[model samples]
Target: VLRNLAHNQRNHTSLIQAGAVEPLVAIMRNSWDAAPRINAAVAVACLVGHEEGNPRLQLDETLVDEILDVLDAACQGTMRHGSFWTVWKLCQGLASLTVNDKNKELITEKGGVNILNEVLHDSHYNNEAAHRYALSAIWNLAFNAASRLVILKTPGLVDSIRDIVHKSESIRTKEAAKGALWTLGLEQDVKSLSETMAQDAGWY
Candidate 1:
């Protein structure tokens, strides 16, 4: 109910005022069913997506971990697409939270980099939407130097971003990858890098 209503920006304020955050977090944490969890994630994303709701969402210290746990469970479960969408929305929400250093540190402490990198590496799923969302989330986290360093430490993350920037037809994905690499100080010359990657992939 709150999930559906939160789509409107005006209603986001109402929902937050109605104290939807705590119950939504609980849904993410306790819902054994995938559908409700996914919906709850979407609702949370929509709510926190509004500037006003960010502080309120951040008030729940356990929210980040709960969202990550939901993401993890979704990835491991049978509802692949649902989980992917859930991750996408969750990433959007988390991206907004990066303005706070504590939130950034909490995300990293809760293994966010590895989880997002794993999503990026899951080629078997052939999920470009998920990849783009994961990239956006990573890009958001990369805004912090410490988080950027943590991401760069992840094995093959830079390579993965490079591949996405060079090979992905989606400009959004390419741009997000570029932003992430730029933050990590990995995007030296995009033209040269793309050319090199294309040559290696025989696209040139």
Candidate 2:
């Protein structure tokens, strides 16, 4: 019910005013069934996705942690399309809340960067859309110096991103990967590769 109501901005405002964050976080954290978890994640996303609502939602640190936990579990579990999309939405919601350095630090402290990196490396998923979302999450999280250092220091992260830029056929994936590398001061490497590929194709 709250999930449905969250689709409308006015209802979303009301739900937030009525203290919906705790119950939604509970459903996201405790629900055994995927359907409920997905719905709960979507509700949370709708609530935090708006600028007007982000301030209140950001005050609850546990809500962010629960969302990241659910997303990590879903990525490691069945990899069902619905589950993957729900997790993607959850990532999007986190990115939306990351309007400041403090929020980015909070997300990194909650293992958000590691979880997102894991999703990018999960070959079993093989879903381009999910990969794009994970890349976007990482990109958004790298908005601060501390978070950017975290991502750059992660083992094989730069290589993984390079592989995506060099190999991914999807333009969206390549663009997101490029954005991440650029954030980490690797734009020169990406440009060099682009030049190499262009020369190889005789486009130079």
Model 2, C-alpha of 94: deviation from truth (Å): 3.3
Model 2: per-residue lDDT, tens digit, 1-204?
777677556787779889997798687767766657656766776687655334434424665565677778777774443544344555555545565456678888888888888877875344676677678767777768888999998887778888888888899988988888888888798898788768877997
Question: Which prediction has the highest lDDT against the true structure?
Answer: 2
Alpha-carbon lDDT, every model: 0.70, 0.71
Q: If scored against the real structure, what TM-score would every candidate get?
A: 0.69, 0.70
On residues 1-204, what C-alpha lDDT tens digit does candidate 1 reach at each position? Answer: 677686556887778888997898687667776567656756776677445335434423455666676666556543443444345555555555554556677888888888888777775243676787788778777877788889989998889988888788898888888887887777675666777877987986
Model 1 misplaced regions, further than 4 Å: 4-42, 48-53, 59-61, 78-85, 123-126, 189-191, 194-204
The deviation in Å at residue 47 for candidate 2 is 7.1
